[model samples]
Target chain A: MRKLRYRFSSDEALMLAYRDGDSGAFECLYHRHKDALFTFLYRGCGQPNVVEEVAQETWEAVINAASRYTPSAKFRTWLFQIGRRRMADHWRRVPQQESPLQEAAEPVAPATGPGDEDYTAFEQRVLRAVGELPADQRDALLLREQGFSLADISAITGAASETVKSRLRYGRTQLRAQLGDSL
Target chain B: MSRDTRREQGDALPLPEMNSPPQLDEKILAHARARAPQRRVTSRPGWMSGLAAASVVGIAVMITLPGQDGVHDTLPAPHWEARERTPAALSQPEALQADTLTDDVAQDARVDAQNGTQKDAQKGAQKTEGASLSAAPPKAVAAQSSARQSAGGLREEQARPDAQALERKMQAGASAKKIGRASPQPALNAVAPEAEQSAYRTPESSIERDQEDRDGATHQRMIEKGLETCAALLRSDDRPAAISCYAALRKDCGDCTLPPTLDAALEAQASDSVTSP
Candidate 1:
């Protein structure tokens, strides 16, 4: 009789399969979340060099801790926790750079009209407004954008659920004032 | 507005992407592949860990048990230490009673044979003295001799001795009366004049007879006192002594009354022994 084979579909399942010596499962998980994870770090720090370094370190930490990964929380939550930890460590090691609001004030390609150009400008203004907020608020807003629930964000950030809710509220209020009608 | 509503508004904003450097993905995947085949299983689920702990406890118990070695210079025999602890295997009181009964009967038979031999020697001496001193009335003598003959026949058959002794005493009393009437020797004259004419009836009107009657009553009281002592000891909770009391009653006082609770206690003990094993 032929032996039956199992397929890994979810993030946790794939990571566990990779820990059990299936290299293909790890590749599947890496492709699935790499773009979203990189975007989160990029928006989080706004320094491409630091973002790349932290993202690399986060993936490395995931690989190293794979054998100990329990499904107590979502795989996405686990992935982002390592990403946030690495970002925190990078900030601790390097001096703080100019904030994104200052960078947004600098000149760029001129706008054509209130068409696609105006919308792009509005999107840039929103990003800059989000990036200007305090680090806690910015992280809460970014995790919320990535479709994480308040409880999951709390777990990833190591803050209470109520605190995550307050940070998100503050972040939105600040971004609304910064962007005005663009919000 | 609610925090969740504001959160949804913030979530609608488009964020610019800065993808991970191509080289980093290659690096992590390479490491994951290399380590996957060599990963050591360090952590286990709760049930697996619990099973491992239970197995370890079982192994520890097996290692700590006594008598592991098979080859010894002297092997101990398998038997219970009665004084050290009661044997759980003795489930039947009937077996214990049967064994103790056999031991008691053997002991009594040996003692009875010895007493019979000694009594025969003493009887020969007493008969010679009686004949030389005085001749008893023939009728009374015949009656006493017949009673002794009957006792001897019963003794040979290993019948009960207490009943035989009572029969002999009664017959001897009858013979003493006839001798009192017929013989006028000084030995008979030493008795009171009214006593010489007495028919050896049970407790008649006489001070001397009454005294003799009181003495017999005292002897009977002593026998009753012994029976009560044996019965009281048997009724007690002291198990080893009570078992001995049972054997004594069966041997010496076969007709003694035993409380119903004795049989109940034996049955309870037998059940306890059976239940444990």
Candidate 2:
């Protein structure tokens, strides 16, 4: 009965419940967002090991801050914001190496019929193109894809709405140019 | 921007699915559960403090005021009854004694009035006989009798038509004797000067002796009254009242010894009660 109630609860409600000592509410909230948060981190920081570390740290930060949480923004926006910061912190500690996307990229696909084209290869190319984008653009693009408004992306990135818009536009234009015809 | 425009402008990248590890989930959930807020113990109700304060105040009042039950319990019953009986005894003695002695005095006064000249001769003979019976020195008795005769002659001269004055004088003498019986001071003071001048009897010593006698009389009266009450209860077959009355008498007059008849009666009643019950 309690689990049913927790499952149906909104993200903000779950966080509030966790704040008031309902560990099950936190479990529900963690499960709901863990995959998206892990993916965001995994894509942003292209190493699984670093992604795991950052994801763990981000969730730990959320757990530590449960008592102090306030529903000022969307739960996902706040979560991604913490993840971005953790990733940035990791980047600061260990300088960025050669882009992992550069090693994974393949030759541009020849113009052909949609049925004949390798869709999986095309999808991988698209992922690499997104990963290859500048960090700010990638964050703005990824946050926008995760269903945040331009304003929400700005809030998560601590950037102006105009800056977020510019980053998103720049990131999309670059992805289209890199994955031409197979788009 | 419109949804279509925004979607058209963004990349169609297929992001790979990812999730935190099972061990990591376990670790984080465990930490959260460990650090969860605990339910606080509820405080004592407001009425409890009020009740405590009321109890303290009640105890204080009980301690501060004199206990009416204790005063009644500790007071000796016999002495209390004696004190209650004293006023009636003091107030009624004259009336009580006057009833007994009035006829004798009236007869003597009438006889004396009828034999006027012979009364004088007879009074002289009677005075000599009273002086013979009195333990006072003869001279002292003669002097007192002479003083009384002179006072009686004056009284007779003032009211010669009736013997009422003589009767009044006799009643006054009887009342004086009653008062003397009630308290010894007046009777002691009435002693002849020769008797009062005895070596051992100073005024202070006489007063002390009178007090001791008064106390002894009062104690005796108390015991007699208590015994009478016990006897009445026993006669009425109120065994409990009788037992209680005897118990009180024993408590109040610890040195008093009960008469054999009353003691035996009480013993028989006690044994009967115990055996019957």
Candidate 3:
């Protein structure tokens, strides 16, 4: 009954409940956002291992900060903001040997099944194009793809709204140029 | 279409499918569960608070009640001193009361000696004679019997202070006799009839033969007031306060007899205090 009740609760309500010592609320919240957050990190960093590490650290930071949490902003925006900062700190501590775009540019594997061939190939192409864009443009485009408003993207990335708009425009233009006729 | 909307529409493309591993979910959830905040304990148990309140009230009653000096003051100095030296004397309250009456008579003799008033000297001589003949001996014997019946059973230790008080009374009588010798003829005439009449009197009336009956009447009024206070406390259903008031009464007036109902109430309250947690 409690799980069913929490399932329909808003993200902020669930987070407040977790802050007030209901672990079930946190479980409901984690399951709701785990896939989206993992995809965001994986697309940002282009490495499965780094995605898992940064995601775990981000959730750990959330758990440690539950006692002090106030509902000043949406829980989703706060979560993605922490994920973004952890990803940035990881890159700062261990600088990439080469650009993430260069690393993603080498990733074309043929689909195993005929039924998923066309869509899988297209999905990989789009992900690769998104990964190859400059880091700021890619982050803006990805966060925009995750359905954040322009203001939310600006807040998460700590950039001006115009800067975020410019990044999204340039990123889409680059993806269009790279995957020209297919897009 | 607007430029930003066109860009947003153009960027809507298929994304890769991904999810975090089950093992990592288990690990983070375990950490969250482990770090969950515990509810605070905000109140104590009912009995605990009751016990604390009772202890505070008991301490306040002990601090506010009167001391034992009022009853002990009427006793002669030498007798009080000797009783203070003997630890067992404290347990013999009846003997102390008997000693108080005897010492008051002695004090009257001393006052008569200093004043050299023939009337006071005659009264003093009569009281001194009454104490030796009719008042002091019977009360001292009754006090010894009561002391033997008391819980401590210290009759012999109680008798020692009475003997000291009696010797002091003899000294006061000798001084009064010296004053009487100054006007031997008139003093004899004044005391002769009263001495014969005092012999047939009861011990209670004899003990009431103070030269200044006003002092005895005032002491009786104080004892009555104290007992009334004790009775009022019991009527108000404040057992602890009633017990405290009764204890003060006993300390102030050791010989003052309590009515039967108040005595029974005090016993019941004392038993309840002993039996309760």
What DockQ, on C-alphas, does every prediction get?
A: 0.26, 0.23, 0.31
**Candidate 2 chain A weakest ten by summed lDDT:** A107-116
Cα lDDT tens digits for candidate 3, B1-277: 4434644576565667679999889999999999876544568889998999999999999788735333234333543343333334433444444344333433343333344345356555646643453334655655653442352223223333443443345336533332222211111111122221111111212233343355556656775576678878878998689778877866776554543345763565455431110
Give the better candidate number (2 or 3) by lDDT. 3
For residues A1-183, write the lDDT of model 3, one tens digit per residue: 999999889998998888888999999999999888888998887788888999999999999999888989989999999998999899998877565644543434443321354666566667878878888999998888788999999999999999999999999899878877556
iRMSD value for model 3: 4.2
Clash pairs (backbone) in predicted model 3: none
In model 1, the runs with Cα more than 4 Å from the true position are A1-8, A100-114, A118-121, B1-11, B37-277
- What's the lDDT for all of these models? 0.57, 0.62, 0.64
| Model 1 lDDT per residue over B84-201, tens place | 1222333234223222222222223323234533533544454454453224454554454445434533343443343234224434664334233332212121122222112111
Best by lDDT: 3
lDDT of 2: 0.62
Q: What is the lDDT of residue B172 in candidate 2?
A: 59
| DockQ winner between candidates 1 and 2 | 1
lDDT of 2 by residue, B132-190 (tens): 43545546545654464345434433333334433334335433232122211111222
Tens-place lDDT per residue, model 2, A17-93, is 88887888998998999888887887776567788889889988898888888998888889999999999898888
